[model samples]
Target: MKNKILVIEDDRAISELLCMNLTIAGYETVAAYDGIEAQRLLLWNEDADLAVVDIMLPGRDGFALMEDFRAKNLPVIYLTAKDDVASKVKGLKLGAEDYMVKPFEMLELLVRIEKILERTGRAKRILTIKNIQADLQSHQILKDGIPVNLKPLEYDLFILLLQNKNIALGREELLKRVWGEEYLGESRTVDVHIGQLRKKLELYDEIKTIPKLGYRLED
Candidate 1:
C-alpha cells in the first residue's frame, strides 16, 4: 500500500502542486486548505501517516493545529514561509519531525518525507512501479512477479533511482550515493552501470539520459 500523507496549507496552488508531486512519487495525499479543515479531516480520518503543514493559515496556524495532529499520532513536517529562528525552535519543540522554509525544493521535501516515514517505521516495504516491484526490506527487485537477478551495486543504484524516480541525478551525485565518497571512480562507471540496469530491467524508455546532467528514472 502507498503511504498516505496529509498536506495542510492555505495556498491552493502550492497545495495542488504538492499533492500532484506526491501522487507522482507513489504516495496517497489528502489536502486541507486550512487548519479548521485539517482538523475536520483528521477527525474523520484515522490512518494518515504524515503531514506537511504551513504555518500561516486562515483559521488556526500550524502551531495551533499541532494538537490535532498529535491526537491522531501523525508525524509532521513544517513547510512554511516563516524563516525565523524562533519559529523553527518552537516547531521543533512542538515535536515536528522536520522544518523547511518555503521556496523549498520539492525533491528535498520528498527525500525528507521518505526519511521521516522510514525513521518512524511507517514506510512501505514494497515499492511498485508498473510491472516492477522492489522489496526494500529484502533488497530484491522483481519484474512481472518473477525475481530479477541484480548485482549488489546494481541493486543499490536501482534503489536510488527508484526512490528518486523522475528526478534528474548528476553523475557525481550518483557516484557519491551508490559508490560512496571514497571509491574514486570515474563518471564513466555510472554510465556503465546505468547501461547495465537499462538492459537488465528492459527500461530503455523509462530510464532517461539527461543531457549535461546524468540520469532520471521515469515513472
Candidate 2:
C-alpha cells in the first residue's frame, strides 16, 4: 500500500507545493490549511502513516497538533520556517521523528520522508511480555485481553524493553535509542519515563531496575 501522509501548513503556496511534490514522490497526500483542520482530518483519517506539520498555524498551532498526533501514535516530521536551535530542540523533545526547515529542497524533503517511513516500518511489529501483547502496526497494547492506553513515549519505551527482552539496557543507550541522540535531557529522564510506563503497563514488578546500570524486563 502507498504511504498516506498528512501535510499541515497554513501557507497555500507551500501546502500546494508540498502536496504536488509528495504526490510526485508516489505518496498519497492530504493537505490541511490550519491546525484545526489538521486535527479534524487526523481524527477522521485512519490510514495516515505520517504527518508533516508547520509550527506556525492558524488555530491550535503545530505543537498542540503534534500532541494529538503523538497520542494517536503517529510518526511526525516538522516542516517550518523556524530554524532556531530552541525550536529544533523543542520539536525533538515533543517526539517529532524529523525536522525540516523552510525553503528546503523538494528532493531533500523526499529523502527525509523516505527515511522516517523506513525507520518506522522497521520497528518491531509485535511485542509479547507475560500476558501483555503490543501490536506496533496498530499501535495497540492489550493486557490479558484488555486494551491498555500508553502515552507515545511510554509505548516507545515499552517496545524497546521488549525488543531487548532479557538484555540489560543502560540509561545512555535507552536515552539515545528512544529519545534520539540530540536529546539534551538528563539521564534521570529515562527513569521518570520508565516509571510511567511501568505504572501504565501494570508491570512495575516486571521491570527490574539495575541500581547504577539501567533496566531489564523480566521474562
Candidate 3:
C-alpha cells in the first residue's frame, strides 16, 4: 500500500506541486489549502501517515495546529518560509519530525519524507516494478519470483534508482550517495556499476543515460 501524506499549505501552487511530486514518488497525498480546512480534516479523523505543514495560513497557524496533531499522534514536517531560530526551535519542541525552510530542494524533501516514514514504521516494505520486486527490509531483490544476486553497492544503487525513477540523477550525487562521500571514487565508477545493473537486469533500454547529467530509470 502507498503511504498517505497530508499537505497543509495556503499556497495552491506549492501544494499542487508537492502533491504531484509525492504521487510520482509512489505516495498518496491529500491537500488542505487553508488551516480551517486542515482543522476540519483533522476533526473528521482523516487518515494520514505524515503531514507537510506551512506556518502561515488563512485560519489557525501551524503552531496552533501542532496541538491538534499531537492530540492525534500525527507526525508532521514543518515546511515554511520562516527561517528564524526561535521558530525552528519551537517547531522541533512541538514534536515535529522535521522542519524545512522554503526554496528547498524537492529531492531532499522526498528523501526526508522517506526517512521519516521508515523510521516511524509507516513506509511500505515491498516495491514492485514490472517483473522486479525489491524487499527493502531484507535487502533482497527478485525477478520473476527468482532471487537476483547483486553486490551490496549494486543493491543500494538499484534501490536508489528505483525510488527516484523517472527523475535524472547526477553522477556526482550518485557517487556521494551510493559510495560514501570519503570514497574518493571517480564518476566512471558510477558508469561501470550502471552498466552492470543494465546487463544483469536486462534494463538497457529502461535506464536512460542523460547527457551531461547521469541516469534516469524510467517507469
Best by TM-score: 3
Task: Assess candidate 1 and give its lDDT.
Answer: 0.91
Better of 2 and 3 by lDDT: 3
Q: For candidate 1, lDDT tens digit of each residue in 101-157?
A: 999999889989999999999999998777899999988899998999999999989
Model 3 pairs in collision? none
Q: Per-residue lDDT for 1-219 in model 2, tens only?
A: 357889999999999988876765556799999988998999887878899999999988898887899888899999999999999999999999988898897756765776687687833366677899988678899999899988888888887787555556789988987899999989998999998888877888889999899998877
Q: After superposition, which runs of candidate 3 have C-alpha atoms over 4 Å from their true positions?
A: 43-47
Tell me each candidate's TM-score.
Answer: 0.93, 0.56, 0.95
**Ten-residue region with minimum lDDT total, candidate 3:** 39-48
Backbone collision count in every prediction?
Answer: 0, 0, 0
Ranking by TM-score: 3, 1, 2
Q: For residues 56-101, what per-residue lDDT tens digits would candidate 3 score against the true structure? A: 9888999999999998788999999999999999999999999999
List runs of model 1 lying over 4 Å from the truth: 181-183
Q: Sort by lDDT, best first.
A: 1, 3, 2
